[model samples]
Target: MNVMKRIAQSALKKTLIVAMATGAMFSTQAFAAEKVYRLKLAETWGANFPIFGDATKNMAKMANEMSNGRLEIRIDSANKHKAPLGVFDMVKSGQYDMGHSGSYYWKGKVPNTLYFTSMPFGMLPAEQYAWFYYGGGMDLMNQVYSPHNLLSFPGGNTEFQMGGWFQKEINSVDDLKGLKMRIPGFAGEIMAELGAKPTNIAPGELYTALERRTIDALEWVGPSLDLRMGFHKIAPYYYTGWHEPGSELQFLVNKQVWEKLPADLQEILRISMKTAAYDMYIQAVHESGKNWASIKTEYPNVKVKDFPPEVMDALRAANDKLLKEHASQDPLAKEIQASQAAYLKEVRAWTDISTKAYLDNEAK
Candidate 1:
């Protein structure tokens, strides 16, 4: 009996030792694998620039929390970076691991970037989102950015951008002639075609430019943001949106930095950006409603005018002509235009029946 007991005890001790050794190996592996990644983002907007800046901040916060301290993102706004329009180049060169800006701002650098933002008479917010995620927009966007060593994602959406708070009303095609406006991207080209001198002024300088008569008219955003800028105080002739029906901002990532992230952290970052983007869209709608109400009551003297049919006709003609001319010059530009046009045609049909029909019914 004593001999049998001794042998059993010896065997149990050996089993325990093996188990302990195996657990130690796994613990060491885990210790080695667990890594914290820190990333820096540069944004085009000034610090705490409301809806736009909020998106970046929210994205960073969510990424940190969701990754359980594995991922840390630090954001530097235009004020800190001192380069509002340099986001694309910075991210592409790895100076910034990430960037928050509008894709359209990079049109001169990459023509395909123009199509990803709101085009003239383009799809609305929901429609454009569908086109991006479902209708090959993301793939097309990637096609445009990958060669540049950057990855672009839809950062946020400001539903409908107003035309401009013109110092004077637009009544005819001739009115656009010799008009100096602060516009950018495809719309700038269309305006140029119609004889308007369109230039891009940074947001911080827009008010001073307009006030000093450097720019005759300018479109910043809609009531959601325009109120804060005090555009109505000087340029009260607010025009309705014909350009940038649904303006979408962008997030850019350095390809090398992206590849450095673990699969889980990458997913967390992706989800964080998308959620914050959606939140910005909703907040824009909310702010517009509230501020628009205030505008109607408090700013009764401010004139909210739509461009006359003749001016609209001229714009559409110029838009069509410029698009054809520009698209013909670049194969990629042609492809992007074709995709947006096709997606708009398909999505607008459903939109007419659902949203448009509902709104039409409600307006009565």
Candidate 2:
């Protein structure tokens, strides 16, 4: 399939492209009347990181093309910004007009921010997206970020992430004890409960950290982006995912900067971001299937394992306890958690009956 042709044929692309052509009819006069707006974005990933970085590029390209040169978005990766995890703070302080990062990165600063990203045993992308757009998840998210001078939107989805590449097989919960891993967000907290040492490592440094024994095991997404990182050489055991069912990335806009945009430009930017987010999810599915196939054919030493039932139960219990503790301390956290649980229960019923049932039947 021709990617450009497919995009141009999309409903969104057709609308915006027609609008651009229509505006051209009034070009002579409108050219002088239209003011160009330029914005700078800071992303958490280093330069040219796959999937994550591609989302930013796609968003920028769509915005520029849709707005007909009125809106220009320039991205600065971690190397340029020199602070991968500081995207939220920089965007909030107006140092950058926008940012591409994960919302869960800010949980330490704003406890409620954690819920915006994927949750352990939470709703998948489509369901969580339903919660965001239709089920008031977006409103709740703004309630968390608005006070901080930011507007957060879904940047992209990495789909379901693999558990992690481990140095040893996890036959039981005891196997996790004293294990040093480079996992992050609330998932790291849960690991800490199980006597494992969990730390956050920047993407550029993940390979070196794991190789040099700075961290024993790490989960840096699944095969879509992971195969390129060469983790299989260091850790032979690949575990299936239980945490971060659908890892959603985030795009942050400075509230003041957003309000300054013309209504048409704002709508264009919003649609561009939304389109890119879903595109990333689809792209991940394709990349993962291709890369995992390569791994099976080319890498015989790599081992795949799911956490044993006993270990899974322990993680679930810890997740519940931590969530309760967080909810009790913050009313907003409680509301968000309740909203997710309710939405998950509502959506997962259909998911099981439809998608799950289809897949299981096809397998048989």
Give the best candidate by TM-score. Answer: 1
Candidate 1, residue 268: the lDDT equals 97
Q: Write the per-residue lDDT of candidate 1 for residues 140-176, one digit (tens) a residue.
A: 9999999999999999998799898898888888888
**lDDT score, candidate 2, position 26:** 34
TM-score of each: 0.92, 0.91
Off by over 4 Å in 1: 1-29
lDDT of every model, 2 decimals: 0.89, 0.91
Residue 191 displacement in candidate 1 (angstroms): 0.6
Cα-lDDT of candidate 2: 0.91
